[model samples]
Target: MSADAVRYLVMPNPYLSDGVLDVRAVQPADIEAIRQWRNAQMDVLRQTAPISPEQQERYFAEHVWPQITSLEPSQVLVALERAGVLIGYGGLVHISWSNRRAEVSFLLTPELEKNTDELIALFSRFLDLMKQLAFEDLGLRRLCTETFEHRTRHVATLEASGFRCEGRLREHVLIDGKPTDSFTHGLLAVEWKNGQ
Candidate 1:
């Protein structure tokens, strides 16, 4: 689809909510919180070092803001909020309009990671919202995500949300000096619709 077409589909409003949770465009104020969450959870993220304030600002300016304003953005990110409080952020990243696919990117506040049940519920809801945007709103064919194998809870959440484990990348990354495997999961638009 053309960039303008995509934008038009979601024009005027892009905020998505499921009564309790709200997923809206990332604003300038969200950068610091996002950076903190990412840095605190570096063990599960691809980032190797903490993001300095300047670096985060530059990234928001050069990368994030443009994605929000650009007609053909490679990513469509959003901040996750509950009752007006920021809880997390994620979105359809690495978008391929030609293929009608995009990789899911999600992260919650590190504090929430301690409660497995709550985490699962929140993640599942987030996935549903993401599917709505990807399939119904943007006409995407598929959505995918990759996570370290150690994140078993997260993997289970993906499974519960109907994403199938497609493959495993053995020793794909290093965490705490040990090589770790990663799993990739995918959900087709047809599958999402049928499940609903």
Candidate 2:
């Protein structure tokens, strides 16, 4: 789709106004900062290890670019302040055209994670935007996400955003030498309310 057409298709960021933050499409320039944030968040992000700069660059070249080149299947986005500081980075991936569903993922910087109250509010707004992108912009019917069982805060965030725990894998993920269960959550299009 053309830029103007996409502009018409996307909605305004619900989180931004009166000095609040905004969520925007991720750009090439944002990669290094995003990499730093992602690596810092590895532990809370589950079964993940810190990535080297080379690996991070390769990931964008091999994984991120292909997705954006064909936006039909997926897109990556970032949430940031007008100052150009990255607050969080994530987006939908693993889209199934036949099933009209996609897997959603996101992470906040370690600093943002420390402010629980603000983090919840910021995440709630971010979730609203993700739903708009899925159901409206992408014509998708359902969205799903997964996290390690011990991530109570994130699991609760998903729940509060109307995602239900639909599946669980027992000892499916190895984290810090311990076998940890993973929970899969889902939210149907019918269950979403725009700007609500």
Candidate 3:
């Protein structure tokens, strides 16, 4: 479907915390903020150096806009506070209706990524919401993600969220012109349910 033809609807997050965050649909106005947040963390969140505004705009046109259009293309969500500050974003990618599986990824504002704070708590809550979307709302059997080896915080979060490393692709992707290894982690519905 065309990017302009796409539509979005706000959805409730089944995964709730003590009023810490609210997950809902990403609006047009939120794109610029999300892009800035993502680019600010490119060293950790992306395989490349900081992305230019043009490149980011193109990505939203060609990639993200296509995904959140509906249940078929995939899901995209933003986590906000009562004041409507965007703190994080996440989504399912490459969804397969037949296999009921997809890859997942998420990112938080750089400040919230600090390990000494409630980074783990914020992440755990987001995972619970996404897992519910996968196992119940979407009826997906599995979800997975791939992250660079250098992104230690994300790798740890994946492991702590019941995902097992399926494999590692050595020197698989480039970051700031250097090659880096990437690891794939997978989580099953059962594993999620058992709180593994």
Candidate 4:
């Protein structure tokens, strides 16, 4: 791929408002930073397996950095920063060209905002990016996300941001050794545009 195509994978979405919050593509230097934050953050365990420094280092060194080029079409890694400090991160993963779908995931570095204002802003920018990626780039039909059913805060945010509850998975994941139910949410290109 040319530099232009590689650049597109990490480009910041123009729809995102610029200010204390800024989003950009993840770089080589950011790998360690993200790994450290992911390991320390309690909420991270809710989604993925508990991570260790060794695992993080090995994964990036072996898989990510080597074929960083290949990661473009399927995975877009974004870093969220506030005043030069990384406070959160989010991106679309496992982009399926045939199915026209992808999974959205994010993590806030705790102690960022007192209210959901930051979250609202975050999701607003995220959905805008998704719309652009789906409708303009990939011609995708929908995007999917999963959240704990009892996570009313997140669910409310998704609803406010135009995602609809599609279904539920019973005891889908085990967090802190406890089985947790999750709700699957989705947004179609048309629905997202209409909401805007």
- Each candidate's clash count: 0, 0, 0, 0
lDDT winner among the candidates? 1
Candidate 2 Cα deviation (angstroms), residue 179: 1.4
What RMSD, rounded to one decimal, does every model reach? 4.2, 4.2, 4.4, 3.9
lDDT of 4 by residue, 1-196 (tens): 2243324333334223355566565655666767766766654345365567688778766755554455246766666767677777776767786787788877766554345777667666666665675666657778888887656777887877788999989988877778888898998888876766
Error of 4 at 142 (Å): 1.3
lDDT scores of the candidates, listed in order: 0.87, 0.71, 0.71, 0.66
- TM-score, one value per model: 0.93, 0.81, 0.78, 0.78
Summing lDDT over every window of 10 consecutive residues in candidate 2, give the lowest-scoring window.
1-10
- Residue pairs with colliding backbones in model 1 are none
Per-residue error for 157 in candidate 4, Å, reads 0.6
TM-score of 4: 0.78
lDDT of 3: 0.71
For residue 113, what is the lDDT in candidate 3? Answer: 73
lDDT of 2 by residue, 1-196 (tens): 1252212113343233234656665666677888888777675564277878888789877866556445353444544553556677776767787898988878777788788887888777677777877887677899999888877878899999899999999998777788889999999998885425
lDDT of 3 by residue, 1-196 (tens): 1345334432234333346666665556667777778777776665355667788778778876766545466555544443456777776767787888988867777788766346777776677777777787777899999888987777887798788999999998777789889999999998877874
**Candidate 3 colliding pairs:** none
Clashes of 3: 0
In candidate 4, where is summed lDDT lowest over 10 consecutive residues? 1-10
